[model samples]
Target: MTDTQAVQTPDNVAPVLVVDFGAQYAQLIARRVREARIYSEVIPHSATVDEIKAKNPAALILSGGPASVYAEDAPSIDPALMDLGVPVFGICYGYQCMAAALGGEVANTGGREFGRTPLRVTETDSVLLAGQPAEQPVWMSHNDAVQRAPEGFTVTASTEGAPVAAFENLERQMAGVQYHPEVIHTPHGQQVLTHFLYDIAGLEPTWTAANIAETLIDQVREQVGENGLAICGLSGGVDSAVAAALVQRAIGDRLTCVFVDHGLLRAGEREQVQNDFVAATGARLVTVDAAETFLTELKGVSDPETKRKIIGREFIRSFEGAVSEVLGDRAASGQKVDYLVQGTLYPDVVESGGGTGTANIKSHHNVGGLPEDLEFELVEPLRLLFKDEVRAVGRELGLPEEIVGRQPFPGPGLAIRIVGSVDAERLATLRKADLIAREELSSAGLDSTIWQCPVVLLADVRSVGVQGDGRTYGHPIVLRPVSSEDAMTADWTRVPYDVLEKISTRITNEVAEVNRVVLDVTSKPPGTIEWE
Candidate 1:
């Protein structure tokens, strides 16, 4: 409940625990749960039975993984979990584990049903598959199959690879599916999850945007007290803008939104924040010109984490200094700014190792890169919400779509977009190339089709190219376009060939320092959306 990344909501927030089996999809499952207006968290499979029981969860979900249930080192669950009397739903690998744990027959099968598979419902009136198609397609990725149902459970669906594709026990309020119902590839993923939560788990949908905004405002009011002053780092991105708006709502006129222009932002971003944001939110604004300081601190730094850490430290320092700008004649009143508001999302928290068993993917400036001598207490209202959920809350607060629907941008800015050293020359070059790309994408009407497309400047790597009928060596622009429900998981977007060609052509023709443009087709698992 303090200034941490923990999920703090109203006292009525129902806690749903997701048992992660060491897969990236675990977080995706948690997001889906939140999409249904329910609160969920991912706990590692290594959690002890007592540790899980201590949470006194409203319900439990088991996530899918790559390992077989019978493998020697494969992760296993405590059999006692099934007897906890909570409605449990399992997917893919989780389904197999629960089957094996409950004395069901699991066979090696020597066959794998991956990607999309046809599922035949053997029981149309089944609890889990209720009202679902008799024969439909479901996403499957598993080597082992459940051959028999656990006692008191009815086998409802079957696939060519997994005969026991779906099963449920209405009396026990437990169910599972051999195929994954959490992925978008499954046509009825969300509907299936909704059925489980509303019918089987008997949970109420109380996590609406209105409820979320009201609860967060009340919590911020309690934390800041009567006379406390807060300063939010107002980056141009939607996350920071919404966070600033949310905090301003909690304590009107007392919250100062400080925007530090680090000079690494894309074109027109400064104007967007300086004019559009203030016109929309009407919050007290202070602009700090720290571009030279950021560029100097990052002059010889090429490591992504180092740049992020440096930026994070400088951001706090800037916020601390801006305290005086908003104080004015009240400086002698002795009221100090002690709170720093941020829009740290849930994906940032998981990617920064805030969640159990999640790898430290990268150091997000606000989450993992905060300096040891931080001066202000952190108040991250959107820290527990996903990207989509944050947008919904922004709309609920009556924020303009221009600020709320803006693409996701890193807190460290264009410094991270450049793959090499940080300097003015590289920053200017990347900014030009990035502008062209953004302009092209918008013109092609593909802005909403894919998520943010990062135009990276490979400062350290140059390629030979011919321009203006002469040979020249210049940097190559890497275009990374990905599609996703949330930033937690992403797949490379297959933009039309014409759009790609136009983007590449415009960048090469407009950017003088470079000659080539390249498209990155790697997805989230193997490569992150951002190059660094």
Candidate 2:
């Protein structure tokens, strides 16, 4: 659920369009709609009427944004949206915009509602609030409130500060709520949204993982025909593994997976990909031991961006060599390779300037950091999916739990985990500390609670400590355990002190080079999950 909308439109399923108003709730709204078994898409608030009409949506949902309707640069809706003859639901900022666009009175109330507020249902017959509790708590975040309803709309619900908290126009098939219904903080929120989708818009629940998998497989086969050979880069993580598995299903033996060991991976990862993935899919696999090559190239490079670019460039070079070798044997038999497979997910696309109003944060090695003269066309099967959706597809394809449920690891691997220049010694030190943390967390059955614990090696920094009888200086390890729905935003996990003590003690005792361990208590805004 990155801000990215689905690029490939599902052919026959009815799509519900969720217009994003630069709100954080836009992705959450689309996800909620999907939870109801209905398909949804997100578009920017600046989308024109015709652009939205192009989606041929069954219903239109306006998402809440962090703008005031009366502000100079506030995002407003097109008046033509009201005449689209489709059911429309507006939340928060969308509500204010819709009200102002439909000739209703909206004023900037000095009393702004910031948190949970109670709503009193006045109209029981209203479609949005039908069969729900008369009094319910809803999440509210807005500065302006609707002062009066439009001519034909009825004010269905009210709060203490705002008389027009909710309103609906039955004849026009349009409604609005000043409070956010997409957040789980609002208890009957999903039900209200479901009512609008199924009961009002007449949309059916046809979006499923199984159907999506079949469709993607057909798409891949159509892209790479009967004779073309496709090669995938396996990183031993779920994203690439799942993408390769799907492509393998599409083209069978025509797909060759190339894995480059850059020496930045964690313990037991290489074996997992070489053994488990190959056995599960029964596809052709090629393993390249390029650890020394990567380390040599990254000898003095310390900047994160530079390291990522070098890794990406070297990866392409390594992959191209593998492809050429694989194709050389094929050329003797008159076959040519045409496609290079990548595991680029939707968030990678969005964060790299694909989404409507997003800025380029960092270059994902596989997507934005590829070299200019790449040889083959890309066959990215997981390009349009989120991580969870990719995992579901993995399960649907009968992949083992170890590969499917594996946590996300960066493409640059431990190179990004080390805050300084990477070397064999630093990698080994980080690996040992990382292994201890992972093993202890898993043993405590807290793996599910922590999204990912990036054990970072402060390779260039050293602190003084007393070992047996003398003073010793050693590097410190930073434990960054996070909890998140996606990698976009994350909060530090609150692991029990006993568990943390175990991880700290084990790493300090087992790994000689590591003396102290510190916890990263910062969230995503101030710091990323990975140090580098």
Candidate 3:
């Protein structure tokens, strides 16, 4: 899902390429395809016919985007791509595109449908909507709708906004729907996607967690060679931990796991990596105490990107130094560490603009923040995997529940959690607040319900509040509790009032230099889950 295209995938499964037309859920569509046990990836819409054919894709999925089919400069695909003998499935904007490209009619009928709408199936013999009920609700977001089916296609379904909402040509092995079938809001979305992948495209479901583990382990073993050595930096998160575990399984003692206590992690994270992870996997461990070094590099830095890049550079330096200390003369003579293992996930790569035509949201510490002079080749086993898939692999590897089910933690650590300059004092304050939030969420059994609750310290912002009997001006702690499948799109978790009250009350009472506790109710677009 992240940079694993064409030549990179060592696995034998032919990939299902998702043609991204600048839609937000392009990655989601790819994930859904993978969920169907079909290896899938996203390709830019600009990819030429021959460029796409080189991958020898099992099928091609056209992702929905924010564009009208009839626009003068609308995104267009080469007509020859349709002539290829492969199954094609399009959604929303993609449906309109397919219709217009096949000489069907498309126009803004002034009928706009957003959110869950009732879809009426017109044909029961449809391939995509086969055996489905006559009436069902589907998630739709579009304006310009397809008005007619092309020469050999059948109009299967329709909505109030558009008449030709779903169309398919059985002989050509092509199908499309105007509604988003990848989201949970549409009850039968997965079923329809499965139908297309299986009944129409004849794709097999081979992307299970066990299969993923075996494939990734094989890839790591092949890349690291028989005697090559690799070092993985443990970030105490599932991504890094899973990546380390994969490398350890690939080349047992040759993989040295480094725990860099950069003074930016949570209170008990260093201990978790030093004790729990070691006990779980018996990985060759090298602990690097670079807290002071990280603070020095991050001194006077408040910009999120700057902080991320600095931390990334220092992390590589820490690994490079550890290589010399652990390997000694061997490193000097030629047995230098050949790889730097990172727990880089697909979301990290996507947010870092790993996709074509994707804008950089923020530089993830492991992905976009590394310096140009890095000598070790990055072995990101989890780069093509998402956070959820990484967890599955960790569980498959028999790691402990605590390590495998740990919450999502940013690689930049507490530096980005503090919205201002990160000092020892500020880091301490955020750690305390973060710990309390985690404790409360876990105690309430809400850990399984919500994705992550980021406790941010607004170091530059302070307000006046009465502590006991005196006016106390202290920094505010913002609690971001969001629920998401992947870190891509998130919604504010609808946590119970009692749980929020407990977290807020505990942080205000226990943590010093902080009196105000505010909840960030905004979602991903209007605001990111992290404050910085």
Q: Give Cα-based local distance difference scores for all models.
A: 0.86, 0.84, 0.87
TM-score of predicted structure 2: 0.92
The alpha-carbon lDDT assigned to residue 115 of candidate 2 equals 89
Q: By TM-score, who's the top model here? A: 3
Which of 2 and 3 is the better model by lDDT? 3
The sequence of per-residue lDDT tens digits that candidate 3 reaches over residues 1-532 is 2444212544687889889999878888988888888888778898889988888899999999998887788898787888899889989888778787788988887999999899999998887898889999999999888888888999999999989988888778899999999988999998988988998888889898999999999999988899898899988888888999999999998888898999999988888778888899988788999999999888889998899989999999999889887676676677778899999887777777776557788888887888989899889888788778899999999998998887788888889999999999999899999999999888999988889888899999999999889999999999899998878778999889999899889989998799999988998876777876
Best-to-worst TM-score order: 3, 1, 2
Model 3: per-residue Cα lDDT at residue 118: 99
* Number of clashes recorded per candidate: 0, 0, 0
- Score candidate 3 by TM-score against the native: 0.97
Q: What are the per-residue Cα lDDT tens digits for candidate 2 across 36-111?
A: 8777767777778997787788899999988888889878888898888988988988888888889999897686
lDDT, candidate 2, equals 0.84
> Candidate 1 vs. truth: CA RMSD?
2.1
User: Pairing residues by index, what is the TM-score of model 1?
Assistant: 0.95
Q: Report the Cα lDDT for residue 318, model 1.
A: 83
